[model samples]
Target: MFFFKKFFKKKKQPVDSQQTTDRQSVQSVSKIDKIGKGKSQTSRGLIKSNKLFMAWNKNAEEKKQRQKSGLVADSYLKQISPKKGFTFHSDYFEVGDGVAQILTIVPTKNADRQLPPFWVTRMLPRGLGQNVTARLIQPISTKTEKWTKDNEVKADAAVRQAYGERKVNDPSNQDIAFQVQDMHQINEDLRGGQYHGSEYKILLKAPDVETLDSAREQYKLRLKNNFRGLTVEVFEGQQKDDFENLLKSADAQIGHEKKMYTSQELAGGYYLMSKGIDDITGKYVGVSEGDFNNPAMLMDVDDWSRNIVVASKFGPRTGSYSTEVFGDHLRSISLWGVKIAEDAMIQNHRVVHFILNNTDIEDIGKRKIGADLSKHTSNINMGKGAINPFEAFGREEDKLNVYPTLTEKLRLMFKEMSPSLNDVDLNKYFTQLLKEFMEDKGLWKPNAKENIDTISLVGLPHNEYPLLSDFSLYLSTIFTIYQKQGNQQAIKSLEKIQGVVDRMKEENGDIFDKHTSSVVDNAQTIPQVIYDFASISERGRGIAMAQFINTLGYATQNLHRGDVVIIHGVDQLAPEVKEFVKDNLQKLTRRDVRIAYLYDNVMSAINDKDFNDLTSADYTLFSAMSSDELEAYKETMKATIPSALENSLISKDDLLYYLSRDREKVLFKLDLIL
Candidate 1:
């Protein structure tokens, strides 16, 4: 009770100018005495009232505590006290049960409507650790008008905040204009589509405060390790109550909460454990946990059917990843593919899922791809690494370095990865890494022309490398932090890498040019590059192909040894990116990174040069296919496929797919959630 009083105590307000000593002297002595007597009497009565209120509150709190501890469930209602069972502490909530505590996730910044697979993968239980269950509560629907109004309010607030923050440091309007433009684009996107906004809350329950604290710290570090832009901090004080309310309501709007997401990003994780379609009745059904355990939940429609049904508890299925078992309530397979593919393994091989669609340059490509890539740049692992690329060339351990070497070291540590470049010339790669890092830190002015010139020299297709791109982002973050602290080491680091690169180029001469011809100069204007993909001439498909292969030369650099890179929308990617994927199909498998490409255009994949290569897959699944595409696919694989499947009609009754790719090519009908 005393603790609660302290927790809820209000701060003292400033004394009124009229009540100050100088002004009080003007009052008569008798008047001052009368005022003091009146004040004393009022104070005594107020104190009595306060005491009664405190006593009432204390009693109510005790009852709530008892209910939360399970000592007393409501006699009439027989329900747990959802509203009263938790008390907010400094940074977490303490349950009345005393043993359990709750912590909610606070994102570092707002996330996109479509979250990338990499971001989704990092959220698995493995990343969250043991004894912690993450409950993601998202709204399934909302009225469009309310959604628009809410978003507009958020956008206005965001703009005002950005303007205020920028005004102090930057007199120039350029930064503010950019912020306004971004907000405008976001507003337009929110207002244009069937997009429903969502709030993300990861409710983590732990056995005790000590365990909760440890798990929270580890989870935060892991978040920083895996994700670039958005990690999470634990919700503090009243925020715990807000998050709890969110869990109970799911779709209810919480006042003044700044973070909002679109359904596209959050809905991918939606799943339901319901029975498959009924054979006799042809009806799909969902059973409650109690009903599932009871025999009467199942109905008998056939003759000579058993009257009784038996049910028993069983452990959840094993070896199957979340993606395989994602139940049939999804809006986008591509979104879910990214959501679930990270944790999947097939026959001891890591699986990478890629969804490919042809990029229509005039339409979605020019607008969406750039924005998408920008979103992913920070979503990918661009934080902390093992090596400090910015460290001065040669400083003795005892000598005081000009910069914070330790900070740089931590920042340079490539997201949960060892500093293994895998056949890449580390020197050359880091040189590029440093240049981009300097640009990010604002130490070097960004030069689009310089980038183009370099790309031209290296061959346009060879321009963008994933490893350098990610590492540069990481270094940029590190250098920016140091720069804010008034350190000039970023400048020195940039000079060092640039100097080394220049000298190397001088030494190598014309031999340094991997490809002599400049695709940018010769090839047609390339439109949009997604996921930080290098811009290249669309006409230079051949060049893009060459670059794609060149990029794969460093596949080992980008992908972890056991990574399953599930890439979706490969076709939407620029030619260079697509070609990189195409040429490296076999090479990626060799690096122990298994990749699965999902093409909406089945014929496109079938006609691909690597179509024969795909036949080597352990399983090829065909789902929701157009008649023509199915026929073409069947005809293309007829030699390897079984004769029975040629005549069998695939139906969507169970959302069934024809699975083939075994050596015998035996056709197997399978039901899948996607």
Candidate 2:
């Protein structure tokens, strides 16, 4: 919430004062009053949907509290006493069901030199033992020293040298060392109270106003009779002034909330459970204690996506390192994947469900009171041919690859693969739908006339599919975040490639002008010339394969160890596809990358006995229903039959939806079309 837009040092212009203030003011108000009454009226939080969050967090008491909290959500100054350093705090808080109190201490005139007294330090919790229990009070930060970079480097060098040639930055060992000695001091004043940071670091916490006062009296005595004695004060909250101010300055960052679970999210999770997902050690949530037992009301889905069904539960803090103990602590969870589909023949409703997840996130707390975490619910669609992405990508070599019209190049790719990359093809119309990507400098266009079929022969990079240029986009270091990256020579090479593509586009402009749609529509079958606009001699320089690969480096940015991905919808797998998949699969598996995919395409795409089965028992298979099957189930449910019979026939929605009676193409796999 404290993130501010970095200034762009562009040419100066006369700024509109009101416009700028308004832009910043809205965000500030929301942030500042995040825990107050105004927050409820304009209820925005880390979660994607408001209705879902309220269902989990909002209680009858808060509804009334919010009305009052609204008055102080902003720095109205009118309601605040308007004292110089004494802020008029509503002391608003979003803490779990309990009284909250903020304890403030005015430093004595000699406070800068003075340290925590011996008597006070003896009472504090030392991180070493289990007996120091946290109850009504939690001391925030208390620091008397700053860890400078110079000292850090010295510490690192010393620690690393001690390990005898071992890497200096072993994470766990480093963390433990840093936590213990880095930038910390043994407070002699408080009989060895370990403290950190440069400021007076007088901040502390208590559960209620009374405990705060008691803690203050005990500490204030140390500064007794000073010229300006330590004056401890207590307030109603624990949020920092800086954090509140940041929220007040920003516009709404929370996602729009929806009222009810979309038919898909609920139906999908429920159906998955029926398929034995109940054993996944999952979390069940709802508005109340009984809700977990009664799963019907709590639509189970979770993640950062907007306007979808989710299980009922309190969310966690948005900031992992920063704590906002004084205000609303609700946060959102990053979801697996989201898919939108129509119920088609089943109740004619819209369905939004979690995709790619094997089970819902495990609920760590009970349903009744309140939870400290800011997490959300999660689930995956488990239909026929369903395989867990995690299990598929269990070995690093398991791979997921996407190809447009793998005719020959696809073959070469397969020849390169190891045996590991085996995942089924979902065959939704997505992998071929063409992604809309653009470089700010327009690095998407490629030379159609210059085919890079052979890495050694091509003058420049080109696409085999002519129409791919129109729907075509490319990754190059030019306009992407990679712009201005690398050494001068590397940059020059990219520029040359850019020039080549520009020339190609220009040379073919006349053709596009005449046959735009016709040419693009027939990309797969079109002659190579349709894509390549000029001769290699005319194009001058060729873009290297390394350049292309370097540009695509960002694709792996989100990947991490043990993270899984499913590459689906690449239709008609060929030998090259297999080879490429295997090769990458092995490579990724070697690096612990996990993957998964549908297996149906093997039946239609690969009939050769020489090829090994990629979709065998190493992975679990879920028989998800296609949209046709869902429709049939829906129809059967709606048929003039008993409720018992209706429930038995419709097992689950396979995330497949038929746009019409006939299947509509699933463009980019953004939507599900059976």
Candidate 3:
């Protein structure tokens, strides 16, 4: 019974004649519609939907067609194929028989010391074993508008955050007081504009890859030791392409690696004009013989190098040293006892180079050396074992150990000749002997009295002639003692001693006056007379060199518009000498003279006040510093940097990085030469 009921339920019931006919027609029509629409039909004549399935099948067919055409499989490969502007090249190239690679030197970010670009070059190596060339490509200075705007934006945001909303009715403005102060401080620190971005490139060359690699490592090590804050990187691969593009136009809109620096920074130590190569505009000064007077000779060609007069404070002396004299008689000039202890060199139409030691001891020691007299006096003897004159003279009595026993013996002889002489008479004879000794030693000059009067009338300080002043004081003491004695002969003898002191002073004052003029004049004509004054001590040589500079400074006050004077190796000069040169520099520049002063190990002198002023320059070039100098310089850097920067605590390293990155900071001029 259950089976029959299920069968009956599943079976279709018979209908009335007209209705059944209509239903069959409807079913037939539905089936036709399903076939046309791509739908599947069921066994019971019911319609089924499969639209999603059909659409998916269509997509699959399209994908198959694309794969067959090779479009889908190779799409990623197309992206990596060689393009129009991409190429690979090594940074190194073969030049003659060796390989050369160009590298870039940049200041390290947040470095404690912003080492100069030239310093990197110097660190690379020098001499015949190592060959490297550096090219400094400086673009215009970097623009500060973006950095300024960024600061303004940050400041505005900070203000907004601090004050979000303030009501007029608020009891006090204390809530944002710290913020206001910070803002004000920030404004103060950000007052100045920033300028930076200079590019330094170096070319390294070696005979083989191994040697080149070794040199590269050595250079890196040197940089680390000498300039810990510097960064060196090879300019290779795509970097070269970018650099080339930058060279074409530093301000181009396209991608590039160019950095902009001011003209002054670029010109600081760059050989802008290669002497003869760039000396086309001026009169021929002849090829530089790389002599001490090269600059003098070249500058003489200009009209400004003549008619120089001594500075008023230096006394009424005229310039006797002429560049023309140096040029006309290059071989005949007599150096006239001029010698320099420090390493200094001057090249015509080139830069002056000086190597100054960092130690004060060396400077003092150099000044103390008077001459090499052992050669002349070594073999000489007071006939057969006679007591040595210098030995007989008590070193304690001769404070400077300057007088010999012969001098004392001579004084005694004079006293003996006057048997009835009193103490006053003995004093007179001793003074006369002293004067004669001074004359024999070339410390006394015939015009000593005239020079003395000149110096006294000008009110010059006694320190200018320290040794002479000491002698004069001794004589004056004796003169005072005999003043009451009324000893006329003693008075005369004491006066002669005064004359001796005056003569020595006069010689020092006039050392440059006649010696420089004579040397410059006869340098070209009488080369043999170019006496090194070897008999003079190193101290004497130092003194003479200082005087030479003094004379040149005063003598060439009215240099022509384009005249250039190069003063090198001044670090070893005495404090007084440096001051004198500094004053003379002003005199030289008062007209149109351009002065180039060269110094080495300048970092050591930066802490010294006198040297600080000396280093002040329109343009400056620098090299690597010693480790000791670097350590000392760090303290200076710490003091120089601002305490805070951009709402953050700033370290000395940060300040130096900022200064180097943005050269126009208060600590650095926009045109500073690195």
TM-scores for candidates 1 onward, in order:
0.27, 0.20, 0.27
**How much does candidate 1 score in TM-score?**
0.27
Tens-digit per-residue lDDT, 1-674, candidate 2: 00001121222335667543335434544543454434354335434344444543444346558757876675575545333233233552323222333333334322223223232332232221222112212122222224223434464565456545445666556544433342232112223332221111233344544554455565555445432344544434434442232222112111111111112212222311121122132222211111112121122221111111111111222111221331232212211111111111022221222121111222222221233222222122122111111011111121111222222222132122212212211121111121223112232223422422321211112332233234224434223534555455434433443443344345533221122222222222211111111122122222111111211111222334443333322232343345544554455455554443323322221232122232221322212233344344345323243343334323332221111111111101001111
Give the alpha carbon lDDT tens digit for every residue of 1-674 in model 1: 00000012222445668644533223433343454456446776666655655665676677678768764445434454443466677676766454333334445433332345434545543434566545544433443676566656776786788777775546556746655765665555555444443444556667677777676677677766665545555444545456546654324434423344444334444442233222363211122121111111121111111010101011111122232333222112233233223123222322322222222211211233112322211211101111112222112331222122222322222211222322132334444555555445433335534443222111113333223334434755655665677746554554344443343234322222233224222211111111212232232333223233322322223443555544443444443234334444454456555555544444555655253244455445444355576667667766533333444433332222343423322222222121
- Candidate 2: worst 10 consecutive residues by lDDT? 665-674
lDDT of 2: 0.27
Off by over 4 Å in 2: 1-275, 279-560, 598-674
lDDT of 3 by residue, 1-674 (tens): 00000011112335657533436435545655566575555644332334434544566577678777787557766676433442334756554556656566555422322225443234434432545433344344354667545755676676677686766767545645545654554455445644334455555667766777776666666666776565567755634443444453234312324333332333333432212112232322123221111121121112222121100001111133332422321110011101111101111221111112111111122333323322221121111111111111112322232232234333333332233445554454664646544554444434554543221211122223224344456667767877889978877766654554454346543331121222222222211111122222233544433324323422232234544544333444555345445655565466545554434334434544344332233323222234454455445443343332321212221111111111322121011100
Q: Arrange candidates by TM-score, highest first: which order?
A: 1, 3, 2
Q: What RMSD does each model have against the real structure? A: 34.1, 30.6, 31.5
Output the better candidate (1/2) by lDDT.
Answer: 1
Candidate ranking under lDDT, highest first, comes to 1, 3, 2
Output the TM-score of candidate 3.
0.27
* Superposition TM-score, candidate 2 onto the true structure: 0.20
Model 1 alpha-carbon drift over 4 Å, by segment: 1-98, 109-114, 117-130, 139-181, 187-197, 248-256, 262-674
